[model samples]
Target: MGDMITTSEQQIPLAKRIRAHIELADPITWISPAMICICGALASGTATGFQWWNGAHWGLILLGALMTGPLGTGFSQSINDYYDREIDAINDPTRPIPAGLVSLNGARANWFFLGFATFLVSLIFKDAMITALAVFGIILSVLYSMPPIKFKKNYLLGPPAVGIGYVTVSWMVGHIIFAPITWQSITVAMINGGLTAGMLVLNDIKSVEGDRQHGLKSLAVAIGVQPALLVAYTIINLCEILFLVLAVMWGNYWVAAFIAFAVIAPIYSQIKLYNDASHKNFMRYLIATNPFVALIQIVSAFLVGGYFG
Candidate 1:
């Protein structure tokens, strides 16, 4: 009984540490990128009348899409954690690296392995577009985190870099996986990119102190949090409004309605952000609205497919 109790005790802390590493890898943030791909797939498939689901390897395609986030975005996140360890020490010591839940070398290994795996998986789909976009995504992820090219240090470029990598690249990869490229796919990618950039800006709201201390010029660090919040809101609201208008133009009332409902959460979060720019409030705003934000791409799928009508 004593031996068993000791083993169980050892496992408990190990499990918690593993959980922390995974959290640092950020699986939750992966959903948006993966869903963005699916959204593009739905839109392109609908427009091109391509039967993506009818293929023998459709399961592989789905797997590839799911892997998009874990391999691409999650890898980028780990690299960011590795590079940002010093900043995290100041702002979020509870993070895996700073807390010693995961070693710096472990994070770097994960980044390289995930990047290679992500690219390898794309080849299984045998689609040139998918491969191209996957390669582009890897490049962008490296540029975002690796030294001397860390776009994350620039307030003007950082958010947009993440947005393009997460939304635009993923979206285009999904679009061309089984369908011909179309203007609809391009437009949707652009819109999602802009909105995702806004979301990245909002993410910076919680990192202002760390960023400023680290000499990182995130928008929130460069400008005051309030103005950064305003810019984020304006960008998000504008893209959403553009999406609504485009949905109406496409006769996608369902999509428009979905977007309108989606807008409510951001509006409320903005109100909360305006009320307080503290990290706690920003975290609250994220928790209150992130799932809703993930659903936006899903709604885009429905919109393009005209599922409501």
Candidate 2:
């Protein structure tokens, strides 16, 4: 009985411990952020749509996009844990960093490991250009997450860098999806990046307290919560207006209408969400609108791609 009790006690805690590490990833919240990059690649210059139609090239593109996003996300997350070690000890002591499934040195080492993996796959794409961009991504990922250079702590720069960087990186993945890239492909890529950046700024609102605790001056902190959210929605709405107008002009009235409705529904939801804004409510509020904008962009891309393909 004593031996059995000891083994059971040990096993249960280890299982609980593993679950804690998984929770640190915030996987539920991170799903779209990771997949959106893949969708962006599909929308811009689908790996499957390439003329070369070779397995090896498509493998590289697919592997690169997957690594550039989630792996980079993992690195950024590790760094976030490193910087927020103290913060996590306060707000989330059960997390891996605080509970210790990952050591400080281990997190740093893992961050670099993923960062290096990102570079290796990026190098497999369009010569040194893709490789250079990959290097920039790693630098920025570390820069945003680490202390003394943690851009996520900044209001003005953080959101744009994260969002825009995500979009552009995805687009660059698309560029490598094809060889001898063209002007049209690059334009679509930028648009994808721009719209994604817009959504990210809005997301910073929900993280305000956590960011503020760590001296992270996110948009909500820089401009107060309500106004920052208002500005975020305002820009988001404006993008919707532009998208619809351009779609109509190009005779893609269907896309314009779809976007028009998609944008409106979120505005309505946000208006309702703001009225009672508790911490729980604000986190819930974040759920109502953030990913839809990127979803619309990705949807629009597929629509365009299908129309042309």
Candidate 3:
């Protein structure tokens, strides 16, 4: 809404403005809210967790939901790029910072704005656990990006750090909204986080060449490309299957069925590329669609709601 209200004395092309805004928003990469909800649905499906729809009426987990996806993510990414400008310049010259589409100060300003927004929105959670999770998301994001503890560059630690930040905080969404925390929620979130971390490994696999040149030791760099791809695919696919099986066995197969149906095309396409290995670019080109993968997750969560009375 704020971005849409363009002011006068602005001569920049509207297309460029829109495109720049998307870049500003970081425009939903693969790790979007889809997983948050899928993870949410799986968490919510439990007898203890948040029910899809309460018998009373429809309610929303506004706080954890907000902090996990658009708001928390937008701030985290802007700050991440601000700190990693040099590395990104080499690895991603076309990005807003390197291309001069956005300045360091402007990006920093956005980081502050979004961070404050997350904090303000977090009040909606009310519960101490939910509030704490939101705070953790903020801190982990900053810690993941900042120095002296820049976990982003650590091969073993980086992926898990990022994945855990997302999956657990997101699990809280369903937990507080539907029910309290359960072993089921924790297990599902951990497994789901593992899957996301695996997808991230594929991203590093695509960027290994650039990362090595930049002196960054990513998981992909540690394992190398071929092995890394295998590892990445294995984890993501495993997570997919694990959640599906768990849901089905619990008689809430709707979530798994929806997820499988949505991902069949992307998985097939990815497998085709792997068989050839001639189009490595497809790896990067495709990894950005993670948010789309996340969207399927949201659908899966919604489907889980249906299996209930």
Candidate 4:
């Protein structure tokens, strides 16, 4: 037992533990939710005609970003890594947990700490609605990864769960920081959720092998890869087109024009992905095209907030 403990300590050396903890939190995945949170703030600030130049206002916006990004998202990712460690062992052995860089107990502690921090920070906003939304976000994040109700096990439920958590909830939190959420904000946020769901469909492709082994019905595992790609790209493109139509109908021709232009590259990449449908191609497509997806969301937020205001 003493030798085993020594080996374990050697596996996760003390000096490298901080970096391992960060890796377990998966900071790279925080970008989308963080940016969307900021977009929510922008939309609310615009719609409410709030003073955008106020330093306090900007500070609040940054705080919301922190909740969604590092605190909330960090909680989500850490918990997910804990629950999905078995899957990760098969799919990505290099991950901190599977790589033995972080012990399972350490991972559990990390997520619990993050979840508690997220809750505490939400209270700092001093709004019941914001606090409620924050609680809901935490619950959703837990449901997405934890047992029995692990939403990620069901192809139909999983992607949308993530979308709502990562995009819609984050947006709502940001919006509520500055103003009450309106129908327009809710609608646009849900639209972004749909877009995220579509992207997540493609994301499942990389994990198909492990998903199949674990009986997780991810889109790529349930449907053939090529067909899943088609479905994903269709959902993505349709969401964009819907947003474009909404912009035009709202008489935001500049936004519409920008959306139209922004979509071309992604569409081109989609065609390439559709033809090949390999994991490498999927990564390339996401890296090359997802920026436009983000740009569209930001532009759509401005359109909705400006016109509706």
Instruction: For model 2, state the Cα shift of residue 196 in Å.
Output: 3.6
The candidate that achieves the highest TM-score relative to the unseen native structure = 4
Encode model 4's per-residue lDDT on 1-309: one tens digit a residue: 011111363555677988888888899988989899888877775536335778888888888888899989999999998888888889999888877788777888899998899889999999998888778888999999998899999989999999999999998988888888888889889999999999999889888999999888898888788899988988888888888888888888878787777667677677888898777778889987688898888887777668443
lDDT of 2 by residue, 117-176 (tens): 777777666477667767777787667777677887776677667765666665565555
The estimated TM-scores of all candidates read 0.86, 0.80, 0.76, 0.94
Q: What's the distance in Å from true for residue 126, model 3?
A: 1.2
Single out the weakest 10-residue window by summed lDDT for candidate 2.
Answer: 1-10
The alpha-carbon root-mean-square deviation between model 3 and the true structure, to one decimal in Å, is: 6.0
- Clash pairs of candidate 4? none
Indicate the TM-score of model 4.
0.94
For candidate 3, give the lDDT: 0.65
State the lDDT of candidate 3 residue by residue for 117-210, as single tens digits.
Answer: 8787767656777667667877888988888687887878788877887665676565566666666667666776787788787777656667
Each model's lDDT comes to 0.77, 0.62, 0.65, 0.84
Alpha carbon lDDT of residue 300, candidate 3? Answer: 45
User: Clashing residue pairs, candidate 1?
Assistant: none
